[model samples]
Target: MGQARSQAEPVRDDSLLEGTIWTPLGSASFPAEQPLRQGHPPRTEALPERTATRTSRRCLAAALEAEKQWARAALGAIGDAVLTIDLRGTVTYMNRVAETLTGWSQREAIGAPLSRVFPLVDGKTHRTVITPGRRAIEENRTAGFALDCVLVRQDGSKLAIEDSAAPIHDREGRVTGAVIVFHDATRSQVTLERMAYLAQHDPLTGLPNRALLTERLSRALGLAQRHRHLVALLYLDLDAFKPINDAFGHAVGDSLLQAVASRVQECMRVIDTVCRQGGDEFVILLAEIRRPEDATRVAAKLLAVLGRPYCIHGHQLLVTLSIGISLYPDDADDADALMHNADTAMYHAKRNGRNGHHCFTAEMNTRPLQRRRTEPGLHHTLQPSQLVLDF
Candidate 1:
């Protein structure tokens, strides 16, 4: 060699670096450069290592792009709502479900403050609630909304929702943003409430059941004792329910019971509670009363309203109630004793005469024992075939 020529320098390819690419932090776009045309392929044997390295990088980029696309598709196809926010507390992404739930489109929500896009409030107090994403970012961990959290949408409508938020971190373990996932919880919340209502109420009449009545009675007694007020309990039994149930079957009997519950509720104040203690028996609670006469007036009004004819299933049915009254601290101090005394008084009203009311008395307690010992059985006195019901 006349003068040893320096090894030919390899030509660098700028097309690969110029292509647009996406990353979690950001993305960019650029016009694609056309490939160079040559008469023949260049010999790469001289620089096989450089050629292989470039080819590997191109394949890796293509794989990464495919994975990114797959992830985007998966997120968009999910049922639950998904949202992402940047480090500046601004919205960056919203899935289709998120758009539908928050009533905000991704185009309009992007770059907007997270609070403006996803507002929340307490379901009970209606107070503003912090977005879970904000909490996750501040705390650098996962967070979730409390039970009964409500989401206020863009159109002003509110939705009951459940959600969780987690901080999104980069490869270097630095928190770059936050992501939230949520779903509508309205149906589940309604189901829970309906179950609770059914547990404490009569399914037929939709009135408080025996358990609820007992609970309220105990509460009323506690408050009465503290406030020095009198609480009254009225025990009532249908005067002619058995014969009607036997004659018309349970359909008409159930309807009559519903009507009775409705009328009893109408006669009561908001403070009073009316409960169905199964079958044709009901109990009314007067949370507070000034005198025994107040209880008597309520009983009288109930008798008059209930005595009216009820048109059920084309049958004009007439019914009456035998109501017995008892007072807390006067008849008995405890709920059970008060209930027992009222029940005894109800039996007294039934015996002396049906369709009337009576106040509990200490002497009346002995009457039931005496009558049961001296008189014949009630079934022996009246037969099912001989029983005549008025309708």
Candidate 2:
């Protein structure tokens, strides 16, 4: 369909629409000057049929132009980019957002190949990803880019985009063209990543937190169950951490913790997971363990590396860890129960001695519970708003 412009007439231009029929893609001339037309001749008995035909043609063109304007306005008002292409994959129209995103205006983008104007590639490998409009044409249905797709703009810069295209069909249900819609996804992706990090990580140490630890353990257990492998869960508590933080300042303590996390990572395999369970406590998961002794070996290595003196801002200080060990299947039924048993063992190690490791025993659970229950209460302390006795 073509857009109409105003003109005076017996419309010298034989075309039904005297004004420019604006379709670079459609069958019409763009904006131009029009020759003036004089008044029509008086009606005759024989001329009525011819007059009626011209009137019908004029009405049709006007209606078509109105439809074209409505479509353009609707597409332009959209916030997301919109691209339209003809059957040959040539770009037919692009709205304002599309122009900004592809860095090509409607005037320039028209008649250009969809790939030339809107190229996408693999975000990591930079390999050419299939152009969606062309793909839709080939598939004869809606098509979209894969995850981590990057759009290559006219200026040669890249942006993450989520876009899809569907073939436009003719009156007979034949695919005639395609319309694609897309939006920039960079900010949304970044926000999602940031939220994920904050939800599962310790802010001070940048290590996975208790919530993430449980998740990792669950996955590890699932894998171990399938592969019939041993999974080791270690809960570590830094020895003398409270006094070190109180005497050396919290800043130094945080620095030491960061250093400790770094060292711990270095000591483990890439398949392993280490998460901080808040404040001087960390959990490590070794998912590919072959035997029970594999955990003890790792515990020994961790003690050696973490026990090394840390020089934080010129203050030389030594630290050690008390680790609790629990094995999958051998210790507990589920990840949470496994970690709980490991945590109980950690406290057992702490009570018996500092800077050592303890394996979970059935009795360890009862001992810690008994200790907590027996600890003296502060019920004798005076409470506010209580009745006073005149002794």
Candidate 3:
């Protein structure tokens, strides 16, 4: 009975502690109760801070790597050759285009001097420039001049190059190196020169056209005005050229005009310029003429040349020219006035006789002034005597 009472008392005490473990307000006890079956309810594991930090670092490194790859791809995609060199003239960077322009690969060109890799020459002299890189670096200026040079290829073939050089500068306003961009301008330059020549010259007769002739006449007049000298302007019209064109065809007419143009050029002095003013008309600018007789001599010489028959395309063409002379300052002041007076004088020569010469006079100006004021489209053949023909 004593042993049973002792066991019952211990059981009663355990029940009291269990009942107190959960209070009326559900407050927790001092020490957590461990389950008998499970070992301490498996203590919850917390994540380490170092592991999270390591994960974030890995993500940032991946982002940086992706950006670097994008930049490299962008640099490789450009068409123009890009080269970066140090101030000491050593090549530090070169793109794919650079490798293609110069036969040296980027691997071989890197760290090589620019002069040794791509040498340039003077255009006019064809001499190699010794220190182009040094000039760009020291001067801190850009330079661009025609350079006729040859590029040595990897396969030993030579490529002719016309290149322009420019200096590259840093953020500190100092020239770091130079970059040269060039292409084949051989065919293009020749085409341009031919076009320029054609613009200033007559395509048929190969003489100065109206535009160049006028420009030279203006300059000659200015010089004459300064030196108190006279300039002779002669206007010539082929009299029987139309008949030749009608009978023998346009090809014969063109041949006759070309022959006449050559003959007219031969009659004039070296200082004089003979210009074709389109369609059977020619103008001669006689520079530094002393007297009016000098112009008469030129007109006589032109008439003699044109009096001969031209044999073209198995046809003999005969043509005569009527010439009119006008003196600068004595006839008119400016280019327009001089040209108009000469034209009026030319018509007078044509009306007086088919083959003759007429000079501008003061009475010639009055008739044109009267015609301009009264009659707008009055077409009258002015005779040498009716309009002032004496200079």
Candidate 4:
């Protein structure tokens, strides 16, 4: 009777059997065969056709869901702000950084206009910076903004931002949307500006230094030549400056120098460039000089202004200036030569007497050759025989 029942009708299989599992879509078997436990379901081939199809579909749906979650995690992990816009410039997606940068949540930003979401402007001009997303999509390429771009956040605060946009292409090579990447640039921009300022200015007096003076002189020479004009350089030195520093403490002497710089600056036109050429000296470049005598007039005014008494640290002090003038194209063709000639004339003024001005002449260049003969270093190189003969 038991043999007849088993052969006559199909029954639930209680015994384990390993075989290929056939589903509606395709077949997938288990990794390995184990005993068919009594409470557990039978092998895959034992399942109904409809049930097999349902199980396969669920697995596919779960895989797609996991892939989407992974993509969202990747976008959130990026450091820079990121957003995506359609070809029509509508905001379609935003990462966590983008939401933070715009001060808008992802839900609030999606489906918004790109301009409304970004709200960028030129920091210097205060004019609206055109959104690069539309341009990138239209041109089917990438576009970027200058470092001066500023983004206005949702709360009305402004941030210095730099960004770029690239068009998204479909498999068919058609532009579909654009991706934008941006980050804060305020710190780097300020640091670069500060470094550039310190490079060209003096630490003590906040005036242009000699290196900057040379740069401006070259530019001024170009303009003067183009306009058929001449550039004049007035090199100035404080007469007996060392003795004053010796008489008083350096702190008081520094205050006196700072005061002198102010008065000297007050004696020039806005077109003039006054630069501090190290201790107790300054070089002034007068751009677009109509007459050589114009430099002489400016030098006289500066001497009068700088020679006034200065009260520093409650102590009265008196100082005088010696100025030497040289004209571009007349004194020398280049900036360095003009500076050297002016320096020579300043010493010539000192030799004649303190507190005066002198115009450079061709004979001033010969002073260096004369000085080399009497230079103190040359005395060190003299042989004992030469000294004995002199004795």
Candidate 5:
């Protein structure tokens, strides 16, 4: 009977072990070896399955953390300021550049309306700039625009920026938000304005140079032709300038020339143009002249201005100009031809005597011998008929 009981006890324990909860280390009996009372079998509790579920949840949490890290790194790398706004123009996302440009951190910027964070104005008119986020939400279309604007920083300083905005869309092909990109353009814009100024002005005299002078002359010529009026061209050559340059050196000569240019400019009307045609020569364009006497009066004024002595570098330099006057249509048709005839008359003034003025005439072109005789210090023994003609 004892042997039979031992054998039955082993079978009963084996059955209990199979039905009870088991760990890797050991197995636990559910009833703790108590005498069998009712007809209920031992209950089994799940342990490994619960541990597997907890591990899976931990792995999923780690993956999400890694994705967030990557997204932050990418947002910080962009050079331009980037801002994302919702349909109502409320800020949703802001990159590092945006924070720096707007003088607000991401914590301060997000959830705030765009107008409250960064006010915008039109590039030209300084009025309120169009809101792309509101438009995108209202119209449900892809809207975009670019403009130059001033952004007020947190410290109350202003920054010049070029801003571009585009509508942000969702997976359903519906516009839901807006993304704005902006960058600094102050230095570039200033450089462009400086270049434009240099292109139109002379660096030396701070005056409009040949290119600007030609443009003005073209307009003046058109007006003169329309009104059937005469325009005068005055070609001026500095008399004995080479001697002054040789005696006082180039520095003093340049100073004297600048002084002479200033004096000549002061003598002219605002409607006239005075331009330096290289070294020791200048060209003047006088518009709306009614008679030849008007050109003579301007020529006399130029001579008086240039005839004065200039004190440069403690040296008194006496300089004078020989001016030649040529009337439009009487001398030639266009600017080039008129300039040429004026130059020819200047040579006549130089030959007659430096520091004088002469008007161009057709007779001067015909009588070559008389032109030669008019030169300064050219002695010719006059015959009886020539003496009578001169008287």
Candidate 6:
């Protein structure tokens, strides 16, 4: 009966394993005793496929690494500073410029708080600046930093900086992090200020130039007309300046002009403006003076002060100015007329002597005020009436 029952049971084939194996063509399986055929590729044939897969994987990894290195190089080589932070406000990455500007290394700054990496303050208000990156991350938008912003570095040094922050996003358009780009704008700001200063001031003597003088004169005239106050304009020319310039080099001449400008500035009040018209000519605007005699006093004081000898570059030089005074309502009303009359009076002062002041009068204009230049010196000779022209 046991033999009969064993004969009734079907024998299971262990060699015919029900398992899948990778092949060169695809996945397949067969009995262990069966030879590999066109329908079923052998295990040995799968080696080429596996090797090719490995090679593809290695190539992909190498390309990704190269891309990462290229990105780092580009970031490091940029002129502006770059910093990145996660949504939690933790620093994630920093470029070379960012490291130098913030005084924090990437190794030291990574995983640190954003505030620790980038500390800022207002340049004018001296208050703590709010981080725009945090706002950008939270609001999911780009934000600009404050104007005239100053950055206080990790080592306690400070620099002027301008920066902006933008929210970074993933492929799905979800906000992932924030990027902050900044740069050192101190040099640029200083350059702009220097340019503006040069526009209105004489580069040689550091005095107000003709453009600035005219602007101030116009404003002063307006205020004087409104308040019924007197405004005085004193036109001055350095006597024999050309002869001295020709005798000495331009270096000595420049030094002499600077010295004269300094002396003239010292003789004026805080409310006055001393201007350099051009060359050795200067104009003084005495705004809101009490009386005409007030200008006379200033002129006398300037003559006394500037007439003194100046020691420059081991040479003692003496210079004097021929000043002409013009009043707002007394000489002429407008700025141009007042300036012209003052200039005419300055010529008269030159005609009288080298070191004196004259007040403008209508009679001074009646004569041929235009003078012809004589050779050998800056001596002037009165010309015909036709020679008179607008200054």
Candidate 3 residue runs with Cα over 4 Å from true position: 1-119, 123-160, 163-189, 367-391
What are the per-residue Cα lDDT tens digits for candidate 6 across 113-223? 998889889999889998899889888889999998888999898899986999999889999999999999886778899999999999999999999999999999999
Q: lDDT tens digits, residues 1-391, model 2?
A: 1122233324454465445333223213323364233453222343355456667988999999999999999999988899989988899999999999888888999999988999989999999998888889888999987888888999999989996899999889999999999989987788899999999998988888888877888898999999999999999988766666766678988998999999999999989989988888889999889889999999999999898777776677777788999999999979879988998888787777668999998987666443331113222332211211222
Q: How far out, in Å, is residue 216 in model 4?
A: 2.0
Provide the TM-score for each candidate, comma-separated: 0.59, 0.53, 0.55, 0.54, 0.56, 0.69
Q: For residue 210, give model 5's deviation from the true position in Å.
A: 2.2
User: Relative to the true structure, how large is the alpha-carbon lDDT of every model?
Assistant: 0.85, 0.81, 0.71, 0.80, 0.74, 0.84
Model 5, 1-391: lDDT tens per residue?
4455457554532334434554543335434676444753322343565455556766887998998788668877978788889878899988998898889899999999888677766667777766655665677654554466677676767777775677888778777788787767786688899898788766665566778778887888889899999999898888766656766678977887788779888988988888887777888889889998999998998787777666678765666788888998777778877877887788888877679999887766665533231333322332222211111
Determine which window of 10 residues in candidate 6 has minimal summed lDDT. Answer: 382-391
TM-score winner between 1 and 4, please give it: 1
How well is each residue in 127-190 modelled by candidate 1, as lDDT tens digits? 9998899899989999988878999999999999997999999889999999999998986678
Winning candidate number (lDDT): 1
Off by over 4 Å in 5: 1-118, 123-145, 155-160, 163-193, 363-391
Model 5: weakest 10-residue lDDT segment is: 382-391
Give the clash total for candidate 3.
0
Segments in model 6 whose C-alpha atoms lie over 4 Å from true places: 1-80, 86-88, 95-97, 119-130, 138-140, 146-162, 168-176, 183-196, 371-391
Least well predicted 10-residue stretch by lDDT in candidate 4? 382-391
Residue-level lDDT for 235 in candidate 5:
88
Candidate 4 ranges with C-alpha deviation above 4 Å: 1-154, 163-187, 367-391
- Backbone clashes for every candidate come to 0, 0, 0, 0, 0, 0
